[model samples]
Target: MTQNLQYFLIPFMDWRIMLLLWGGVFAGIWVGAIPGLSGTMAVSLLISFTFSWEINDALAVMCGTFVGAVYGGAITAILLNIPGAPAAIATGMEGYPLAQKGEAGKAIGLCTTVSLFAGFVGVAALAAAAPIIARFALKFSPRDFFLLAVMGILLIGSIGGGDPIKGIMSGTVGILISMIGMDPSTGELRYTFGSLNLMAGISFVTAMIGLFGVSEALTQFRTSGAKSPKQNLTKVIPDWPTFKKYLPLAVRSSLLGVFIGALPGTGGDVAALLAYDQAKRTTRNPETPFGHGAYEGLVAPETANKGAIGGAFIPMLTLGIPGDAITAIIIGALFIHGLRPGPMLMIETPHLFWMIVSMLIIANVALFVLGLLSVRPFAKIIEIPKSIIMPIIIILSVIGTYAIQNSVVDVFYMTGFGVLGYFMRLYGYATGPMVLGLILGPMLDSNYRRTMQIAEDRLFPFVSGFFTSPLSFFLTASIVFMLFSQTKLYRKWRGIE
Candidate 1:
């Protein structure tokens, strides 16, 4: 125990490691706040630069940047109605409305505060129960993942902006669009329309950028003459009472993040979307309605995505498996450093695991401090003139779209999506469900096929498999409960509606 403690304290005593952590967080916040630049990209770039550095230094920077980038995603979501990252999609639901109401500071402050709490929860889980959680993550079958995608689809109602039919329509279209590329399991062309340009399929990131960012610019053009919201920046940090009020929700969403993050392929985006839906379902009599300016809406997703930071590390450290895209890059980094990251990782180098946990702890603190300091500046972005800001947004969208794969065709596609999203907004179809559909559609498709193949295309076996496996059974039950909860009968029983 003492030796473990010593390993944990090593980073704290090394001033260079501490500086690297802070610097990484600082750089990460800005990079992540920009649409299209991901922590994955940032860390991947860092690999070449950090390959010659000591392992501890590389990890410190990567850990800080990872935590900061996740937190930075919310800044654009709240202030600009554009999700800097996919994980912030749910955040844009409530956050932009709050910003429109001139409460950007409070929204970001609350986000930062809850995020720190969630970061701690995830770190605690990593430190105390890494192996157990990692093993549990491994138990999830393709069917179970498919169930998760189903749960994600059910969220259309929650994010539908009070229109179920429109939500379903939009989500259905998004799913169809998601299928336009080659099928995942097979080499067969799908909806590619005999165009080589469509062979690679549309990236959800491009869709998200167009649907939210460029479309937002077009939407604001109608009101270009309207003055920007005058933000109140005094309360940049939540008071104790305010923080306590959100404590229960923060805890719930954070745990959700940790678990989902531990899942091999699923990451913060999935966790945040699920947490937002859970919050929408559970919270009654909110200060404001959901998809508007509900504080609960801000709290749920921010905490969840932050918790995912720690959760992503859990599997990486314990099993040598990448938890998410960024972790996947880090795994490659570990390999370059002559470190084998798997079952034997701990047995051979126990200090590495302990050091990582501690590094995350320090990085979370850095996120809290840096996040609060940036609230005033970030909130100020909302006050920029629409005429100037909208054009800049369009420029940025084009740049970001091109950055994805250096494809000019994607830029055109993004422009088309922007126009489509504008029409969607005009017709009262909320854009959220469509993005959700885009995000979950592939997961559902790939997993269901895998499960079917495992069952040898037999109906009875496929049906029975869900019940036979403990995890599948739980997921099936949860899906049933979700369906029931959406019924009027359940609402009446709960006396919520």
Candidate 2:
């Protein structure tokens, strides 16, 4: 125990290591606040630069960047409706409205507070329950993943806010768009339309920049010369009462994030969306209507995504499996550093495991401080005049889109999506469900196909498998309950309205 404590305290004891963690976190915030600059990209860049550095130093910086990047994505989501990362899509749904209402600072403050708590929750779960959670997560089959994606698709109704038919239409359009590239399994061309540029499929980041960033700029053109909302920055941090009110929700969402993040092939993006949907369904009397700046809406996704940071590390450290893209890069870094990550990794290098946990704790603390300091500046961005800000936003969108692949064709596609999203907004169609569909569509298609192959084209056996396995049964039942909750009968029985 003493040796383990010494190992964990090593980073804290060394000022250089601590300074590196803080520096990485600060850099990560700015990088992640910009669209198309992902944590994966930042970590990959660090891998190249930090190759000659000590493994401990490299891990400390990477850990800080991972935590800070996840938290920073919500910054743009709140102020500009442009999620810096896919995980912040749901955050934008609730947060952008708050920004428009001039409550961006308060919303962000609450987000930071909950994020810190959730980060600790995730770290605690990683420290105490990692092995058990990793073992349980490995039990998920492709069918279960498909079911999870289905559950994600069902969230369109919650995020849609109005006109279920229109929301479904938007979501369907996104899913179709997601199918444009070559099929990964069969290597067959999809909706490429004989164009070589289309064969690569549309990157979701480009779509996101266009759909949220560019479309938002275009929408503001209709209200040209209008003054932006004046945000109240006097009391940015939420009071004790406010924090207490949402504690249960933060805990629930964070735990959900941990479980989802621990699953291979899933990450904070899935976890955040799911938690947002759950909060929408379960919270009977939100302070404001969901999609219109509800505090509960902001709390759910923020907490979940932060918690997912810790969750992403669980499988990597315990099972040698990357929980998400960022972790996959971290896995490569581990191999480069001459450390093997597997079931025996903890036994062989217990110090490394504990040191990582220690580093994450420090990172979360840095995130809280930096997150609070950033809220005022981020909120002020919303107060900029539309005439000046809109064009700059469009330019940023273009730059972000082009940066994704350095393809001018992608910029054109982004402009097209921006036009489409603008029309959709004019027609009262919500863009959230569309983005959700794009994110989940591939997961749904690939997993369902794999499950079908395993079933050998037998529908009956495939259907029976849902009930035959305990995990599948639980997931199936949850789906059924979610579907039933959408009905008038269920709402009336529960006195929902």
Candidate 3:
């Protein structure tokens, strides 16, 4: 215990390590606030520069960046309706509306507070229950992943503003768009139409920039000369009573994030969306309707994604499996540092684990301070005249899209999607479901194919497997409940409407 304590305290004892962590967090926030500049890219670049540095120093900086980047993604989502990262897609649902209502400062303040709390929850889970959670995550099969994607798709109804049919149509169109590239399994061309650019498939990041950023710019053009909302910055931080009111929700969403983040192939993006949907369903009364600026809507995704920071570390440290793309990069860093990551990693290098936990704690603290300080400035960005801001937003969207794969074709694709999104919005179709579909479509298709292959294409056995496994059974039940909750009968029984 004394040795463990010493290991954990070592990073704090070194001022250089502390400085590196703080700097990393600060840099991460700005980088992640810009679309296409992902945590993965930042960390990967760090590996090249930090290879000669001590492993502890490299890990400290990277971990801090990871936590800060996830939090930063919500910044743009709130102010601009353009998520800086996929994880913040759900945040934009309510956050953008709040910004329009001149409550951007208050909304961000609450997001910062809940994010700090959730970060600690994730770190706590990583410290105390990592092994248990890691073992449980291993129980998931391909079928379960498919079902999870299905559950994500079902969120179309929740995010879809008014018309469920239009939402479904939007989502289905997104899925079809997602299928434009070559099939990974069969190596067959999909909707590519023999175009080399189409063979690479449309990157989700490109679509996101087009659908959210560019689309938002075009939408604003419809109503010319509209002044931006004046944010209320007097009381940026959430009062104690406000925090207490949403404490249960923060806790619920954070725990959900941890579990989802621990699952391989899932990350903050999936967790945030799922938590947002769950909160929407469960919270009977909000100050405003969802999609029109609900506080609960903001709280759910913010907490979940922050909590996922800790959850992402669980599998990497314990099982040598990357929980998400960022973790996968971290795993490679571990190998480069002469550390083998696997079941025996903890036994052989327990100090590394404790040190990481300490680093994350420090990072979260930095995030809280920096986040609060930046809220006013970030909110001010929303107050800029739409005439000036819209063009800049379109330029940023094009830059972000081109940055994805350095392809000009992606910029064109993004512009096209932006126009499509503007028209869809005009026609009462929500763009959120389309992005959700694009994100989850590949996961669903790949996992379903794998599951069927495992079942030898036998329909009966494949269906029965869902009920036979305890994990699958639980997921099946949750899916059933999710579907049932969408019905008028269930909503009336529960007095929701």
Task: Find the candidate with the highest lDDT and give its number.
Answer: 3
Q: TM-scores of the models, in the given order?
A: 0.98, 0.98, 0.98
Candidate 1 positional error at 108, Å: 0.4
| Poorly placed runs, candidate 2 (over 4 Å) | none
| Deviating ranges (above 4 Å) for candidate 1 | none
Off by over 4 Å in 3: none
- lDDT: worst 10-residue window of model 2: 488-497
Clashes of 3: 0
- True-structure lDDT of candidate 2: 0.91
How many residue pairs collide in each prediction? Answer: 1, 0, 0
Can you write out model 1's per-residue Cα lDDT over 1-497, one digit (the tens) per residue? 99999999999999999999999998888878878877888898899899999999998999888888898889999999999899999998999999999999999999988988999999999999999999999999899999889988998888888579999999998998898888877889999989998888998889989999988899989988999999988877889999999999999999999999999999999999889988888886788988779999999999999988889988898899989999999999899999999999988999999999989989989999999999998888889889888899889888888988999999999999899999999989988888888888999899999999999998999999989999999999998998888898987787667
Candidate 3 structure quality by residue, lDDT tens digits, 422-460 = 899899999989999999999999999999999999998
Write model 2 residue lDDT over 343-408, tens digit each, in one string.
999999999999999999999999899999988888888888888878988887887788888899
Q: What lDDT does candidate 2 reach at residue 350?
A: 96
